[model samples]
Target chain A: MAKQAPGVRIDGLTVVYKTPAGELPAVRDVTLTLEPGTITGIVGESGSGKSTMALSLLNAVQPPGRIAAGSVEIDGLGDVVGLRGEELRKARGKHIGYVFQAAQNSLNPLKTVGKQLLDLGRSHGVDDLRGLVREAKELLGRMGLDGARVLDSHQHELSGGMRQRVGIMLALVLNAHLVVLDEPTTALDMITQANILKIVREVHAERGLTTLVITHDIGVVAEVADRLAVMYGGRLVEQGPTRHVLGAPRHPYTRGLIRAIPRLVGDIAEAQALPGRPPTLATVPKEGCVFRERCPLRMDVCDTVDPEAHADGARAVACHAVTVKEHA
Target chain B: MVVIARRLAGHLARGVVMILVVATISFFIVRSIPGDPIAAHTQKLIEQGMAPEAAEQATRVLYGFQATGSLWEQYGDYVAGLLTFDLGQSVTHAGAPVTEVLGEAAKWTVLPVLAGTLLSFLVGIILGVYAAVKRSGKLGDVLAVSGSLLHGVPQYVLGLLLSAIFATLIPILPGDGPVDILYEPGFNAGYIGSLAEHAVLPVATYTLAAYGGWVLAMKSSVVTVLGDDFILAAELRGMKRSIVFRYIARNAILPLFTILALSLGLLLGGAVFIERIFNYPGLGLLLIESITMRDYALMGGAFLLITVSIIVANILADLFYSVIDPRVRSGEEVSA
Candidate 1:
């Protein structure tokens, strides 16, 4: 049974990690929205705080890292950041399902898939465990796996592609309308990744889900995401329709990321690697454009002032140079 | 069922081979030690004004072995006796069979040592998990430090300390012996109470000596398990705190099972000093007495028993591992 997909509105979301030096923002003032029944993918390199932003949806950011400032408003769930203890816990699987990064290692090795599914049901106070199992099996079957066989087997028995499907099944079995798939296809072969992304797209549409996919690869978002958001050093550098962003990227960081992806048909020398490493928690600029160091269009003002994401129509880009040109 | 049967058969076959190797080695080693008990006893009898031939005959009967046989011949006899489930007679105890003597002492040692070890394991695991869960807290630090401190102290030293406080200093419990001789050796309250009272110090010593290691091992294991993606995933899935805890404990405790089985096996041998300190008549005390008296049959039996127990424990651990972790059961399939 598919429910009406819920839209998520994240406003002024800032997550900070407590380090020896001090509390440093991992995600700073990020504002994005997942429109109902749409798949949004956020692309960023490692340490770009894309994952941190996703974690804020369920208020699942662990200790040493916390939602320092944020309002994640989900339709019918209120602001999730305000939920705590048992209330917060109940909201997670029931309202917001999260398919973790590395689905291969996400299932308990000691337990069979069915047993863990039963555990999940029991934890969520599902009285009809048999129904839950049936639903889980149905979900698995929909994903083109032998439901009973997959459920009976442990994680190690399943292939990477199979486990990823199992992860999706677990996320959807509870009928949660909002799903977050974090790095859903990182370790798989190219064929398996394509197959998984297709399953994700079909499942999202069939189930009427508002989905968020977080990954480092631009290809992943291009394949499945309706809308794309680009993150750089804890900032949402760009956001727009996937086709528009891919066709005409405005942010310097977004352009660099797209250029870095190797193409099979392109001239081998055309794909260029981005110069300078992504900034870590300690290295992220305290007050300036995070991508300015690597930006070819860097100006004097980029050294001192951080650009706010300025929206024009359906697209948004955060850069002083872009803002000046649009105004001019 | 067939897989289980095959696994059991394999374990038993390996255990038997291991026991046989250990038995053969121990038999030769015990025989090679200087000053045979039969010869020494015969010389003592001769010095006491008995005829040399008569004393030799008496010593042979007393020791229950022919001293004239070559080492290889004796080894063959030992192997034959082993095949028939006979461990030969005790040299020090005169007419008593080695099995009977050791079995009697084993009754005293096995239960108490087992109880102590299991108690320590349970307590240590519970505390260890708490410590790891609260690794950033004061209670966790205190428990960790205490575990390390107890783990480092020798068993005998702990035994002595326990005896000093509970026995000699306060005199609330009996200092030594399995039971007070005045109590009738039956299922009476007095006899059982005295038996339990006597067992307290030795068992406490065993528990305290081993508790720290379990605590530390469990803490580290839990810490590692906590870092696993599954643990975090479980938490994120809106599983109850208690459910998450069970997930954490179940996964964390897997590696410790093998260690637990090993320690259970090795603790029998380790009981020697603690048993000696408290004068608890267990296999350890019996083995020491046998060694001092040069009772080769009893010495060999004790060594073999220890070896057998260790192998049995290891086999059980392996079987139990497969039962708990399905991944281990179909390892070949997993690779495939």
Candidate 2:
């Protein structure tokens, strides 16, 4: 048996948010492993809790949103769920660098980029004053931006594309073991998106940094991800190698998502639009599969019982309708 | 530095325009009323045993107010006097210079307002930030509720109560005037002590009245800033809470800065009700005197000074804003 490489291991993770109405579970019983130097993409619709799962790496979930149960472990960093106060803060950017969804707001509008970057480096106790400044400038330069100019100018002084690139640079500056990007290219133009993806691939190859890309658009993630995990209704429905999973999505939900993307050459009318909206945590069925209400393959048995994942090699899918043969 | 300079210059030009506008409006408003400064003075002269024609001629020459000319001609004389640093004579003061009257009153108003404003900012900002960043427990609730509740109480009501408690009930501080007459008005320690003792109630009255807005404003703004992504980013960089607070609090205090500056301008106009309550000799008392006697030159001078102070304060706020906030400093860069 082959052991998984040293990277992030999120096990039995459950996140519940305390809303005015009641306690609602956002991400439920999710487990996944991101191996070293590999790009793992978590694809889902907006409410699927993919971002919640990603932000849990830093304990960065905002107020009213909290991790109810689970532990997140990085190679040598130990349990993230137990760390608190200064210990938790030190472990954050040092262990995992997060590039947030909003590129424009990622940098503080008040301070120059140079001051922010230097402060970040110095906070980590980097004593090479002159050298660090040089590296900081070069880091932005590597992103094909005017490093010197950006260092002096405020955040709003830059174009949107340039700001997102600078955001990516901020994450890499810390050189964390796992770089978690939550919808990094979502707000960017198509050209900037492609440029950012290329930079991500280049940085990954050069630094051997394990990366997690969480996005709703599967087509974008498919370009650079080595593996894929599909989330629906707060649960991980399917995960395997990126190409294989995209080619043959075993779960009905994953198949529907892939079919929903419009092809330039394909007939527009034939696009398979998923009928129902994603279920809220409160409306999730207690007696059957969470996706049963929307699943085209739902049967009488599916309505009465919950389905569990059946694993073959690294591939796992939580669909009762699909029969699995034991790997030889 | 250049940015601040440019912003200051621009505001100064606008401030000049603002002063001119204020002067024009106040000039016409004072005249629109029925009373005439020259006529009143001539009556005083005639009662002093001067012939009627001679009294009228002397009054006209002394005040430089021509009775036979159009209102515009009188305005031109006023402007000409102002250009030469002559604000005309006080009608009731037996020819005392209007500038001298306003100048004496201005010092008294400036002293209390300056001390009061500084005290409010220091106390309010500290309490507000501490309240926000505290454990978010019962103490925070107490701080928040009590602050706003105190703010709802009017300044004069608080001033009266405080005066009753400290000035009359206990007699710890003087109730009336800026300084005690027995002190002989010297720069010695005893004289200074007497002055401070008299100022205590007025300063307290002003601080108690003004600090509430700052506390409430700082609390809300700091809370909002704490939730900002920049703070999160700082924390993720593994910086201490104290460091994050330094940056976060600076941005949070911006909204409160403008409010404080404006209130300072109002107070300098002589927190009239507060001044009268404490019996503090300030511009408010002077203003009241001018209004009652209809001493046109004196009233005009005092009002003009108040308007200039307010305009200057606002201009300073505009300049200071650009200095503190990068978004305003680099206006050309924003929204690019």
Candidate 3:
């Protein structure tokens, strides 16, 4: 409890949703570590288990969906995956906080913001409500918003941007070692998105809090992420420093994501869409690489063997050709 | 503030219009019925030692009989009389003031109906929220099934079944009226206790019949809300299970407020069947008595009171909408 800003280690994590007939795999053996005091962005299209992975931090993947096989190791708190009932609740309150993607849906409309803050604070065993509120007001103020108005207001009384900021503050209020924000800029305007990203960067730098932001927008991650993990077909295709990965993406799926991003001031390459749908997780191919069908440079060898990830320095990429034995 | 003010004014204006329409219908519809109360009144007047023709003319003038004028004039006068609570004289009760008769009957309906409906609402909300939060639990399944089963049972049938059990089978509670004859009607606890004891079956019937609707209404609403992101957000924040339930139930149950208020308004007409089955002295029983005894004035008075109550309840509900959600207070989605 005394150690500051704990690093989170997610090892061999697999989450699955159980239907009456069978289990639908959502995340497939995803192993990642959140380096303490850094901003990591998880970039993936919707339904890539980006949300499922984030929710597992809170142990809140709703029923029919469960953590099929995994362990989330916080630096001091041990494995969060196995905690149950009160222990799990205690971990959620103080260990890692999460911000939901939707602004209109991040808080209860019927309850006041003060009450919501109080609820979280009380659960974390902070008895001084007045002091807690004062701190919350300051938190909101740091985001360039009016503390008094936001504290007294209802969810509906805030703009989408304001609500998104509130969601971020909610995630950080507990002073959790790691904060996972799922698609923070998803529904915000361009200007609001820029402002929110700036606030996030400032907050992270000041508090030295590790944060994991999940988004499909490459531009958002580019604006803020120190490290990046690109997921495709429920698997991490590329993981490395944001600059290194973006500068020279190794995996074909990562290249597809980079190509999909529209340009602003660069060479103005013609923006091309990635063809075909993401493979259905339940019926995805188990024999070979999941991205083989969508890979631009597929080979007969790729079809026969599921390429093992080749770790190069801090970067690891799973591809037969790109991640060769003597690569880089 | 201005928008809420304007909306409130609009609601009150609508209420006034509804009252007027109700009054006119009550007055004119009774007159248009196959048998005339005026004729019945005239028959009595003739029997009271007056010449037949003079009796007809005198009673005609007293009752606002305008055989020669347009129907619009009659409607206008009837509305004007309703404003003064003048529902003419009852023919069946020897020309007793109809207002006096209705006021007495309203008491029996108001207390029991309110008690039953509010109790039902309380019970329904608790169980509904419980069922919603624990959707897959055994308790939830039981409550859901009970709600559906109870909703399917008619209020009268429930009342009859209660009577069959208490009056015929086991025989404990008095299955009829407001109290036992042994207790002298007074402000004493003995009379009140007996009154409550007698009211047991009737109120139970009304609550059992009504609570199911609230349970279903609240359950479905909460279920839909459970799917919303805010509920998950609440859980993610590590809020207690109780607070999470509040988050799910509060917003979802807001729409049920209007329905609750409207049911109160339905007390007059709706409570009749329940009251009749229980042999309770309420507006429902009075309504039937008025129709059978050909008491047009009393019937009109009862109709006016019931219609006015419904409108008032609806208007109050409109005001309460703003209270329930502050966004409504501003007359727009309250986003800054």
Candidate 4:
């Protein structure tokens, strides 16, 4: 047995949001491990609780929501579930880094980009002032930016891609163990998106920093992630090595998602469009598989009983029809 | 700075046009009311042994109004006088130039409004930021509700209540007026002390009423900014909550600054009633006297000044908007 590398460890992570309508479980019973210096992609459509799962790492989930029953243990910091106040704040800034979507919106429009980066470094008690600035210069320089000019300019002065590159620089400044990027490149154009993904890979390799990248685009997962976890309706339906999962997606939902992507050179008829919208948290089925209503292979047993993940080699998938009818 | 200057120039040009329009409209509005200035004056003078008809004719000739053409001519002459800053004599005040009379009144009226506005702006911003940052708690809710509830109560009502408590019940402050008879304006310590003592009640009254508006504006703006995506971004960047607040509240507060300047302009006009209520002998009281005595020239001068004050205030607001927001490079850009 090989032990997972030191990074973020979550066991039975259940996040329930206390809305006005009642308790809504956003991320229900999710468990995954992110290895050190490895990129893990959590691919899910919107409302799949991927963002909620990311926010939980920083203890920054908006109010009326909480980690209901789970243990989220980072490598250095033991358990983050019950920590609060100054202790929680200290742990967050010193240990975890975050990069949000909409990089232009992320930087304060009022302050110069240089001032923001300097402040971030100083907050972490980086005392060598010139060293910090030099590193910031080098970082921006790496992202196809003239560090000196971009640093002095305000957020509004820069184009969208430049603003996102600066956002990545802010996240990576402190050399924190883990950086949580929730759709960091989503707002960028395709060319800029490729550039940002390249920068992410370069920085991860150089610093050996653990990276958890959340995106809906499987292309990003395929490019950067060593492993993939497919989240649907706030649950991790399948997870394994990227090559294994994408090559042979054992879960019906995963297979549908891969098929849905339009191939660049394939025939138009080969494109498989998944029908119906994703289910809301409230209307999620109580019986049978969560994807049963939309799944093509729905049997008599699937109507009466919910399916659990069955181990197939190193990959895990939650389809009873695949597990019982084929593997069993 | 270049942006602010360009916008200010455009506003100044508009202000000049506004002054002319307001003065012309004010002249006609005052004249259209049927009344003989001569007769009104003669009626008062007759009780003191002046021959009524001769005095009426003398007054009519002085006013240059023997026919309808003369009325138009009078209006034209008055407009010319205003352009040259030659506001004629105040008939009711007896030999004071309209400008001199207004100058004295303006000092009294402007003092309280200035004091109130400064306090309102400063206090309102601080309270607003605190309330927003601490929202979902008791203090924020209390601030929000109290500001709204107090804002609904008119300034005069608030003034009267404050006067009753501090001026009447406590007897620690003067109830009204800029200064008591004993107190005089000068460099002398005794006079200065007395003057300050007299100013306290009126200043407090004005501030209490105006504070609610500023507080409400800022509190709502700050709260709105707190919910902005930028604040969360700042948080994720590991910025201290206080630093995040500066970014959020300062940007959110830009529109309120314009509101502050515009309100200052209206405050000059609204102070008429407030001045009369306090018997402060300000522009409002002078205006009332001029209208009652048919002192057309003095009334025209006062109206022109008030209108000009409004235009200038708006121009200042425009300048401030440009200074605070980089996106608004020019008024032309804004319009485009």
* Leading candidate by DockQ: 1
Docking quality level of the chain pair in candidate 4: acceptable
Any residue pairs clashing in model 3, and if so which?
A: A157-B334
TM-score of chain B of 3: 0.86
DockQ of each: 0.75, 0.51, 0.58, 0.48
Model 1 local distance difference test score: 0.90
Query: Sorted on lDDT, highest at the top, how do the candidates line up?
Result: 1, 3, 2, 4
TM-score of chain B of 2: 0.88
Better of 3 and 4 by TM-score: 3
Model 2 misplaced regions, further than 4 Å:
A1-6, A300-305, A323-328, B1-3, B37-70, B134-136, B333-336
Candidate 2 DockQ category?
A: medium
DockQ pick, better of 1 and 4: 1
Docking quality (DockQ) of candidate 3 = 0.58
Q: Against the true structure, candidate 3 has what lDDT?
A: 0.82
Residue pairs with backbone atoms closer than 3 Å in model 1 (clashes): none
Share of true Cα-Cα contacts across chains kept by each model: 0.76, 0.51, 0.57, 0.41
Specify the poorest-scoring 10-residue window by lDDT in model 3 chain B. B327-336
Q: What is the lDDT of residue A308 in candidate 4?
A: 77
- For residues A36-121, could you state the per-residue lDDT of candidate 1 as single tens digits? 99999999989999998989999999889999887999998999999998899988888899997654488888888999899889
**TM-score comparison, 2 vs 4, better candidate:** 2
Per-residue lDDT of candidate 3, residues A1-328 (tens digit): 4547778899888888898658877887888989998899998887888888888877788888999997889887789888888787767756777877755487887778888999888777888889888888899999989988998898877888999888888877777767888888888888998998998888888888889999988888989999999887778878999999999998998898788777876665677778887876665676678889988888777877877666789998988878553554
Best by lDDT: 1
Q: Candidate 4 lDDT, tens digit per residue, B58-120?
A: 666655543355778877887788778887777656657889988988887788789888887
Using TM-score as the measure, what is the rank order of every candidate, best first?
1, 2, 3, 4
- What is the Cα-based TM-score of model 2? 0.92
